[model samples]
Target: MIPIAKPYLTAEDAQAAYDTILTGWITQGPRVQEFEEKFAAYTGAKYAVAVSNCTTALHLSMIVAGIGEGDEVICPSMSYIATANSIKYVGATPVFAEVNQEYNLDPTDVEKRINSNTKAILLVHQIGMPADIDAIKKICSRYNLKLIEDAACAVGSAYKGQKIGSHSELVCFSFHPRKIISTGDGGMITTSRKDYYDRLRLLRQHGMSINDRVRHNSKKVIFEDHIEVGYNYRMTDIQASVGIKQLEKLDWIVTERRKIANKYHEALKNIEGIRLPLERERYFSNYQSYSIYLEKSFPINRNRFMQELLDNEIATRRGIMNSHRETAYKHLEDKVNLPVSEKLQDRSVLLPLYVPMIEEDVKFIIDTILKLTQLKTV
Candidate 1:
């Protein structure tokens, strides 16, 4: 079956990992530092911190931003659970906000959720689509709230000509296999503030006064001190080695994925019962996951549609999740009402999208989807 997504790794990626292993410094070391520097330069950020994964990146972002228990962070519930989970990690309340047609936090609804307890706004660039950062920034400025970005799926996405990671003060990115880039499994946090960069480096490695690399290179004995409570969230040099190669291929990956997505757009635009993902002016999406929404009056429901694709040797996944509906956040069901988000979650389906896709497979997937929708041709 054609899979929904796959990492575009080459023999060179494996070689990078192999080379790092032979260096005898597999943990966060020179490679990690090099990866961080390259990533920061690529995204136009002053500093970048590598972590275990995007979740930990978000956790660190919250800590450095001074979010704590009793504080509330406004965020959209129509996102991966990790988006809200990160807020919970710091004992802060996650105030669910509504999403607009673009499946991003609606600035109007976000403004409504603001209260005295609200400390920050965690904006997500869902599925590689850039959110309205400028609009949200205005809200933050007016209310003295911090803005943190969950750019897990937006590594190659741009907004108003600027990369996602460079726009926000604290932006978290994922290098999961399913994301645009893969570091096996790793994350990054980019920031312009020196204070945040210094503290994040310390906090990611148990808050030790000196990092392992520094101590290892020292000629004299060095005793480290734990300055504060911190978590073991460092990325290994092995992963960083792979990430360096992945970073080099990111632009090409995005270009290839967009080519596939455009094919889908051209073929499926005429289908009356489905809606395609949006790419508004000035917002450049990497099309991380090509999701199409089935209208309420569509011939088949979301589950059946996905099942049909699977039966035809084309794999598909349900749309973005609604964190508010999950058992972990069930109590939020009564507290929040997100009509747009709920409808989006229930009606949308993620189609297969990846780099290095075979032309025939892409055609087959498109033909099968068209047949299932009873269009046969577009």
Candidate 2:
């Protein structure tokens, strides 16, 4: 069966891991620091803190951004629960906003949701396509809201020539296998703010003023005191070793994904009752997942279409896991009308997309989709 996503790893990654094991410094050591520096340089961010996963990164960002009890963080409803979960982790409330037809946060809707209790705007670049960053940034600036970018699927994506990590004050990236790059399971937080960078460094390692690596090299064994409560969210050196190698090939992997996306666009553009993913002229997406919207006129419901694909040995998924519908978040204020987001929740499907997929696989998927369309017409 063709899988929805797969990690691309080479001998370089294996060799790096071997080296880390041989060195016996596998817990948040030199390799982790190296990975953070390289990632920051790649995204043009002043600092990058490697963590256990994107969820922890988002949680750290909330703490550093000063979000706390009763504070509302405005975020899109059509995103992974991690975006809202992080806000809750900080004892803050998540105010869900609507999304546009493109499955991104609607800036206008976000503005209407902002209240005196609002502290931040958490924006996710769903499926690697950038959200309307420029408009979102403008709105955040107007309201003096802290902007945190949940760019888990947008590692190499850009908006208006600036990288996604550079656009927001705090940006989170995932290195999960499903993402453009992988370190098995890891995440990083990029920021231009020096204070945030320093605070995050402390936060990731149990709020200790000094990290273990620093103490290891010192003549005196120094035990540190925790300045504030923090979690053990540091990425292991083994993971960082793989990440460093993956970072070297990030651009190539994104290029391959984009090639597959282009093929899908050309083949599926004319098919009625199908809405192809759109990339604005000013943006360059990593194409983490190639999502297509099934129009209301489509004869088959999204669930049936997904089941058909599964039967054909092809794997597909619904768009970003909707936060509001999830059992954990159902208690939050549900009065907001997120028409576009809700429609996408019911109709959108993510086709198989990854760096290793070739043109042949792309053709097969597109042909299968077209055949389904033809059958519906009959």
Model 2 C-alpha lDDT per residue in residues 68-168, reported as the tens digit of each score = 99999999889888888899998998999998877789888899998999999999899999999889889988999999999999999999898778877
TM-score per candidate, in order? 0.98, 0.97
Off by over 4 Å in 1: 375-378
Worst 10 residues of 2 by lDDT: 369-378
Q: Clash pairs of candidate 2? A: none
In angstroms, the error of model 1 at 113 is 0.6
Candidate 1 accuracy as lDDT: 0.94
Best by lDDT: 1
Highest TM-score against the true fold, candidate: 1
